[model samples]
Target: MLKANLALLFIILPFTWMISGQFLFSNGDKILVIITVIALITTLFKYGFTPFKKNIINNQYIYLLIILSCISVIYNYFHKSDIINIRSVLCVILYFIFIPLNIISTRVITYSTLIGSIGAISFAFWQKNILHLDRAVWQLNAIPYAACCLILMTAAIILCIIYKDKKEILTISILSAVISFYAIILTETRGVLIAVFSIFLCLFVYVFTTKISVKIKITFITILITIGALGIYTTQNRLIHDTVQGFSQYKQGDDLSNTASRLAMWKAALLLIPQQPISGFGDNFEPAIENLYHENKISSQLYNLHLLHFHNQFIDTTVKHGIIGLVLLLLFVFFPFYILKKTEYSKENKFAIFLLTFGIIISGLTDVPLEHKQVFTLYIVFIYLFLKKTHSVK
Candidate 1:
């Protein structure tokens, strides 16, 4: 029962941000994280710490990543004003990497998908129908809100097709997928669409290339293609021409253009990276990049738009944490793909994690999905859950 509760809370981590956005004074992630920590402690006592100790050598890359991140944070601690924030980040690194993936089961993964789907779908419905908003963003900025929508949507699909849960849960899973699709459309985030499509493309390729049943491959491809077509039709602005036009305007140096603004920030980050290419300037990175924008005499529109980080994860990590930081973060993100390829494992785990990690990387190309509370939290949890070695744990 204790384990079950822990699993439920793990799935609801994404919804915490949803709640925080809705309430006037509430810090949803903080409250949920505290509850999760308490639950984790209770399970640790009941099950013993052995769950986290298994297969340490197999996950040497993950530990190496944790060490590098800690070292970088410590380097910045003496000079950065946000000393507490730096420490908090180090703690998070430890917490995520050390989670006992032994506790994860098929049931837990499906439950997380169902619950997150329900939570995000409800919020999206409320924002669109009752609020009468053209773009349904609830309490989150459009980017994070849209990121949550797609993540939950993908989770719902994985719950159904990958886990192959009971018929009752299968019904719920299908419903969740439908609702997630609707929410993704209403949110109108281009990155969300890209992430979702990338998921389908990745899955389709997997199903086709693997020795899976022909029926499964055909059925899955048909469903995904149909859904993708419908989604593209429903969201008119999420069109190829629209994106091309944005790029064209950006190329023309349109300061107000979204693509142009993102480019400006990326350029600014690249310019400053050479100055501090080792240990970064650290927390509250706005002033450093902003200063460069002034020196370069570029338009200040991105700063005005409250664009905080470089939208690209690789670029942003390199800027704030330097080349060493960038290497660690990349290994942390991509090591699963490397390790899983060389070893035998459950196809479900491989596909689930691949779908997730791939979507994140693709989305990161155009936006800062890592900065969003929902995206990073989900990534950390799923990474540990799917990658852990199979060992019996009580």
Candidate 2:
């Protein structure tokens, strides 16, 4: 029981801290990082870390990629004297390396996924009522939150389909899906909505083609019903208002405030890209964006905000780290999907890959979720575990 509890803590700590870091009034990631280190030490001393030795040594390419990315960051650090921002970059490396090294197994991954899903859903609820922070009717950073929930929901759904004796677990997964859908609506992030719809459509097609049990089919419908009901209850008013506003903006051919601002940021980023095209401006891209916005006389509220990132991970990488950085970023995003294709695994394992792919794609479109130390650490652990499990089965 103690070992199980410690293992669970190691799996979920990174994700819990990542979400909390954004919503909590305090610096949640700082506390999470400290806790993670302590947890790592405890688990290592308790479990002896030898279980992961073969997995780590076998998948050396991932290690190499991590090393290369770190080297690029070091190159940038020296070329541009930006020390504070380097913490974000370093956080990515630490999570990528430590998570895979410490916790990558089927049992650990499954436990982590379950716990992480709960933590993410809980944070969504806290953000809505507890935070009470308001902005535009349709503008919210709920995309990352929703995307995270959707990944977990998809995983749960797949597990229910694959596992027979786990009826109670299936019921819990259904409830989780319902709550996740509720949070997704609150986020008002159109990008995430699109991604979720697309993935579900694909899943629907897959399910239709595959030979699934009638019980599983009924369970799927019940899950959808729960999600739909929860979505209505949670966002009935905002949903109507947002829908009308969205349609009106589309009909009028006018960009919504948030969309317009993103366009402006994209343009500003493009302009700066040429200035220092190779290894562009390093981590000083935020200040560069501010200057560009001011020079262009853009009066958007987003322009006034001290933007830390380009709001798009790919563009941000190109602007900060150049082509090499962009390639590394693509590898980190794509390699897992390739591995998923190559490996013969259970439905739950495939679902994990789909979840990771969906999250990373959505995350790339808006805000650098991967840049956050806590979240990236969680991502790394998930990826490592997925690959290791697949390899073992093969």
Which is the leading candidate under lDDT?
A: 1
Candidate whose TM-score is highest: 1
Candidate 2 lDDT score relative to the true structure: 0.57
TM-score of 1: 0.80
Model 2 misplacement above 4 A: 1-26, 47-49, 60-65, 79-118, 130-132, 135-143, 162-165, 218-256, 286-302, 341-343, 346-348, 390-394
Write the residue-wise lDDT of candidate 2 on 51-156 in tens digits.
4554455464466455655575677656663212334334433444444443443334344455666666566666666776552322234544555655555555
Q: In candidate 1, where is summed lDDT lowest over 10 consecutive residues? A: 17-26
Candidate 1 positional error at 110, Å? 1.0
lDDT, model 1, position 354: 77
Tell me how far the alpha carbon of residue 208 in candidate 1 is from the true structure, in angstroms, after superposition. Answer: 2.4
Query: Model 1, residue 300: what's the lDDT?
Result: 65
